[model samples]
Target: MPDNERRTDQRLERAILELLDRRAASATICPSDAARAAYEGDDDGWRALMEPARRAARRLAAAGEVEITQAGRPIESAEARGPIRIRRTR
Candidate 1:
């Protein structure tokens, strides 16, 4: 991957984790939260980071750092179809 893309990916991952760190251990966060945090601009450009944020969440899930859930139930990242939330693995 290009350096910029790699950096973005890393930033998204860190954003997801950092955001979680600020919440209660049992609390969860939406991917959009990380996307918005990762985005530096003061515009709707964060929308473009949505997919990247989801991908970052999936990567974090694979690394056993987080869980991806839909309807409050843990699901495989690949099986996450619609809206989902990220939470620290319990």
Candidate 2:
């Protein structure tokens, strides 16, 4: 990946982990929360980061740093589709 894109990915990953750290251990977060936290200028531009945010979540999941779930059940990141939530691994 390009340097800038890589940096953005790293930022989103950090945002995901940090956001989870601030919440209750059982709490979950939408990918948009990380996108919003990583984004600057407070505009809808954060919307563009949605996919990247999801990818970051997947990466974190693969690293065993987080879990990705849908409908309150943990699922493999590669199999995740539609709405999903991120939470610290139990």
Candidate 3:
């Protein structure tokens, strides 16, 4: 991957963790939240980071730092499709 992409990925991951930290231990945040936090635009620039945000969540999940949830239940990253949320791993 290119340096810029790597940097963006890092930022997304950091943003995800930070956003999760601000919420209750049982609370969760959507990937779009992290994308929006990483984005510096008032426009639709955050849309471009949505996929990267999901991937960042998956990476965090693999590290046992976060959980990927759908319908308020934890789900396997591979099975996590459609809407999902991120919460700190219990």
When summed lDDT is taken over every stretch of 10 residues in candidate 3, the lowest stretch is 17-26
* Candidate that would win on lDDT: 1
RMSD of each: 0.4, 0.6, 0.7
Q: Taking the tens digit of each residue's C-alpha lDDT, what string does model 3 give over 4-67?
A: 9999999999999999888889999999999999998899999999999999999999999999
Kindly indicate the candidate among 1 and 2 with the higher TM-score: 1
Clashes of each: 0, 0, 0
Model 2 scores a C-alpha lDDT of 0.96
- How high is the CA lDDT of each candidate model? 0.97, 0.96, 0.95
lDDT of 2 by residue, 1-90 (tens): 899999999999999999999999999999999999999767799999999999999999999999999999999998997999999999
Per-residue lDDT tens digits for candidate 1, residues 30-65, read 999999999999999999999999999999999999
TM-score versus the correct structure, for each prediction: 0.99, 0.97, 0.97
* Model 1 pairs whose backbones collide: none
List candidate 2 segments past 4 Å from native: none
Model 2 per-residue lDDT at 5: 98
